[model samples]
Target: MVLNKIEQLLEKYENAETTLQEEQELKTYFSQDQIAPHLEVYRPLFAYYKASKHETFTKDIPLKTKNTNVYKWLTVAAVGVLMLGFYFNTSKHITTTDDDLGTIQDPELAYNEVVNTLELISKTLNKGTATVGYLQTYNQGIATVNYIHELEHTSNIIFKNNK
Candidate 1:
């Protein structure tokens, strides 16, 4: 009768359908010295479970952390020094004299200066326009290739044999 009960409990345990009380009964039966001969294979597994239940962790964990506050303050101090140096350096070179204004008193001289500047800008723009001509030629070549592909597709459609 006990062997039949143990077999039923073992089947329920294998299918994960046994309650905690049924599991305790299985553990108690396996702990005894007279476990059935055919059930000896599960003895070691249950023994391991029993032994593992009493095991405890004994190692200490480290709690030391790095000092990043000093590095953060150093970065802030370096940026402050760089900004002060840049302000002082640029202030020393920014003194504007009357000659720096380039103001022409004569109207004719100002008119000639304006004409010369415009001519220079026109020549630079003409150089850029010359380069754009090559792009126009490339666009024409691509259009010719696309027209050829369309003609080939139309010809294939007209000459295609239908059975």
Candidate 2:
């Protein structure tokens, strides 16, 4: 009778239909010293469930301290110092050749050069050829329209012949 009850409970557990009380009852019923031989296989399963409820972390060791913000501040300071050094080094060197001095001395001429480059790029993109697939589809559409016109013309010729 006890084994029958355990079997019913196990069926319900497998189907996820067992209540908390039914599960506790199953754990208690299986923990007895004398159990049916046929149900012995399920003994360890229930014992494991009961044992796991009391499982806890050991209290003998302390957790390590966290100082993540300090490391982040150090990284920021290192990057800032590097950027300052780079800026100072670059500022000391002049970037003008003899030709650049004559050309770049006027802001209006530099602006015109930039505008001309952009216009050239735009013109190149506008005059490009369509792809092979586009050309094929265009020719197919024209052929379809011509075929429809020929069919209409043939119908008109037959009507005139009948008259």
**Highest lDDT among the candidates is held by which one?**
1
* Cα TM-score of candidate 1: 0.39
Task: Determine which window of 10 residues in candidate 1 has minimal summed lDDT.
Answer: 92-101
Model 1 lDDT per residue over 26-49, tens place: 988999999999999888877888
How well does model 1 score by local distance difference test?
0.92
Which residue pairs collide, candidate 1?
A: none
User: What is the C-alpha local distance difference test score of candidate 2?
Assistant: 0.86
Off by over 4 Å in 2: 52-56, 60-64, 74-163
Q: For candidate 2, which ten residues in a row score worst on lDDT?
A: 93-102
- Give all candidate RMSDs, comma-separated: 11.4, 12.2
